[model samples]
Target chain A: EAAVTQSPRNKVAVTGGKVTLSCNQTNNHNNMYWYRQDTGHGLRLIHYSYGAGSTEKGDIPDGYKASRPSQENFSLILELATPSQTSVYFCASGDAGRSSYEQYFGPGTRLTVL
Target chain B: AQSVTQPDARVTVSEGASLQLRCKYSYSGTPYLFWYVQYPRQGLQLLLKYYSGDPVVQGVNGFEAEFIKSNSSFHLRKASVHWSDSAVYFCAVSVGSTGNYKYVFGAGTRLKVIA
Candidate 1:
């Protein structure tokens, strides 16, 4: 079983506040992703990293930034949090060497921006 | 643009009843289809995947999905439903090159199994 864990499972922040969500994976997967889940939007990718120190923008990366400091850790940062940015965030890791292209996800973090 | 669509946002079924959740995709090239289930307050779990060869793929906990190329649909089905099976199900499509693959997910279907 691939293991992915997230920190600060629940967070509350005010507008203009900076927030960071951390994720750690033990699967040794090279690909890590950050996504936000909303009521009708499902999961929208915000940022992804192919490996350590390589972060790429995804579909909805405007208000979010990602950092992959090491192979086991990834973080999503919100420079200036807004109420609109309030959503459940998920982190996922995938191994490109695998044929299935399956991603293992972490228990999401629920963020509330007031 | 490539996209995945799950028409039903919510589904209600009684225990022991059959189940089916519809999913459709719009893509030009061959697609890698997947069905994932998210339990309450938990991460998404891979239920099944269809890359090639088999149109019908079996997943964990008696769940299965079938890929129909003609309709661009990959509908998940279960022979018998259980109360514990209630969860949000997502359909996704893998696109892009092998190393640079990106997944496009649907809005998801929230299933409610009543005993």
Candidate 2:
């Protein structure tokens, strides 16, 4: 079955610390995305990549960076963690061409910046 | 640009009762609409989607949604909701990816199915 896995299901980091959340997908999809879910806001896009080595900013990309080294791997990087950045983050993969359809989501990672 | 609105923030229904969740979207052109369900402490899963052809799209767990172009609405319905149906439902719009198209999600509606 298609799979999207995220590392560090839960993490607590000190403020100003750098954190990296990793994601891997076996779907072989060309598009990968990062989104943050917060109370009342649902989920907002942070960054996305059309293919390996092509990352793009999303609606809420400030303070967040994304890397897609290969079709099956994508990573979200927090240069400097902040309390406000603590939230549940999800990774997803999908097709980017016209045939692009539904996205398959990962289990998600919960981060805490104290 | 595309946007979605889920007017109701929460809804409660008794087990075996019928339920409907409203979702409205705004986009200049035709869009691909989808409904996702997120169970407690889990990731979001696609329940149903609508691109074209049929207005009513059937989904898993006896859930279906109808697309009303006139109102730009795609409302999800279930003939009989089970206790396990309690989850958060999100409505999203696909704005196309030619120019960094992004999926815009609604605030989401939390459903509570009373046993």
Q: Which parts of model 2 have CA positions greater than 4 angstroms off?
A: A96-100, B98-100
TM-score of 1: 0.97
The top-ranked prediction according to TM-score is 1
Stretches of candidate 1 above 4 Å error? none
- Ten contiguous residues minimizing lDDT sum, candidate 1 chain B: B94-103
In terms of lDDT, the poorest run of 10 residues in model 1 chain A is A93-102
Q: Clashes per prediction?
A: 0, 0
For all predicted structures, in order, the TM-scores are: 0.97, 0.96
State the lDDT at B101 in candidate 1. 77
In model 1, state the lDDT of residue B57.
93
Tens digits of per-residue lDDT for model 1, B79-108: 999999999999999888777877999999
Clashing pairs for model 1 are: none
